[model samples]
Target: MSTTQNERLRGLLEPLVGAQGLDLEEIEVSQAGRRRVLRVVVDSDAGVDLDTVADVSRAISAKLDETDAMGEGEYVLEVGSPGADRPLTEHRHYVRATGRLAKLQLHEGGELVARILTVDDEGLDLEVPGVKGRKPTARRVGFGDIAKARVEVEFNRKNKQDELEQEEEEA
Candidate 1:
């Protein structure tokens, strides 16, 4: 699909996610087997839940049905999180990934796995997550050349904090 079409799809899906308190990580359209698959990747500060996914799926499916955005034939709709393997690519992506560990794939063929020390217009500061030898190699990767990057879903204590806050609210 054209870039414009892809962006349009993001625009269309954003509100649906926002209303349901989820971040629309990305909306991808690609072929799965002989059919088209519209993958709606979602997440939230509280972590996404099944009910949220079902609600999002129903809402987006309705919008797609109304607009016929997929065009011709039937397409499978899959609503999911970006999973632990996907990389963050944009500024908003970085914000969403605050306090997470990430693997950076440089275009020059190298990898840097670090905690997102910080993010700014200059670049991302990745604290090399290991011993003294690595020394938190926070090299400046231009906004370009980041081939593929993603946050790793390691068990973090803050996840418990988030859960507690959610429970407090629900109570």
Candidate 2:
């Protein structure tokens, strides 16, 4: 039930996001008593900001008002970026994290923590963890075992941001 509502909400917001040159990354909808709170997460190659968020939120609210999309109930709208803790799923995410560290959780409960080397049809190639007094190991993670992965953002260094910058320059 909740999933369907959230999908419908995503369906309603996608056009608005497209019109504003943003990519719809995720959408979350929850109910508190009689009020519905809709959180829409959007992103782009360059990222998102407060003004864009405000613009998206207003667009969604207006569209909902015209269509009564929430079905006669008041809904609060929130629009946001994916944040620093963005998950790595799509090939592009791995591509973005090239040379940056990541932690991958395998479906079978195995863990791989290392820098992203590459991502392709063959799947991801990552530098694996090693024990004390030993050099780190590298591993090729077939797509099947990857349950979840996220970039380990290094705040002091500019590696993560550099990835985005490199992408933009290539573009």
Candidate 3:
């Protein structure tokens, strides 16, 4: 799809999605076989639930139906939340990823995988896990210093506070 079409669609759908208390993270149109797929990625500070996705999907579908935005063709509308593996491009993205481990590519050089501590307008504080059983260290990284960043998924991770709370409840 053309960039103009994507921008137009973004302009058309952003307000509708925002009205439902979600940020429209991305909008892309691509061809799949004989049909086109219009994927809309949305998110919120509280995260998105299936019910909210359904509601936003309905609203977007209705709005598109009223307008000839997608043109005279068969298109699929897929509205969903941003996945864990999505890049942290925007400040809000980094903010949403607070408390998660991120793999960052530094603009100057080098890569660092650290757990995000906090996010601000200028930069973020990260807790760099030490090597070889050493103590974890803290560091600050400015947004401009980061060339690319993605959240790292920990499948076997457990929170100490959560474990303690569970033990207390069990006792």
Best lDDT goes to which candidate?
3
Model 1 root-mean-square deviation: 7.3
Backbone clashes in model 3: 0
lDDT-wise, the better of 2 and 3 is 3
lDDT of 3 at 126: 99
Write candidate 3's Cα lDDT for 18-89 as tens digits.
Answer: 999999999989999999999999999999999999999999999999999999999999999999788999
- Which candidate has the highest TM-score of all? 3
| Full-model lDDT for every candidate | 0.79, 0.80, 0.95
Which pairs of residues collide in candidate 2? none
Q: Residues 108-146, candidate 1, lDDT per residue (tens digit)?
A: 899877777677876676667557665555555655767
Worst 10-residue stretch by lDDT in candidate 2? 152-161
List the candidate 1 regions with Cα displacement exceeding 4 Å: 2-5, 106-110, 132-148, 153-171
Question: What clash count goes with each model?
Answer: 3, 0, 0
Q: How accurate is candidate 1 locally (lDDT)?
A: 0.79
Tens-digit lDDT track of model 2 for 73-125: 78777889886768987776677677778888989997777877887876887
Report the CA-based lDDT of candidate 2 relative to the real structure. 0.80
Candidate 3: residue 67 lDDT (0-100): 95
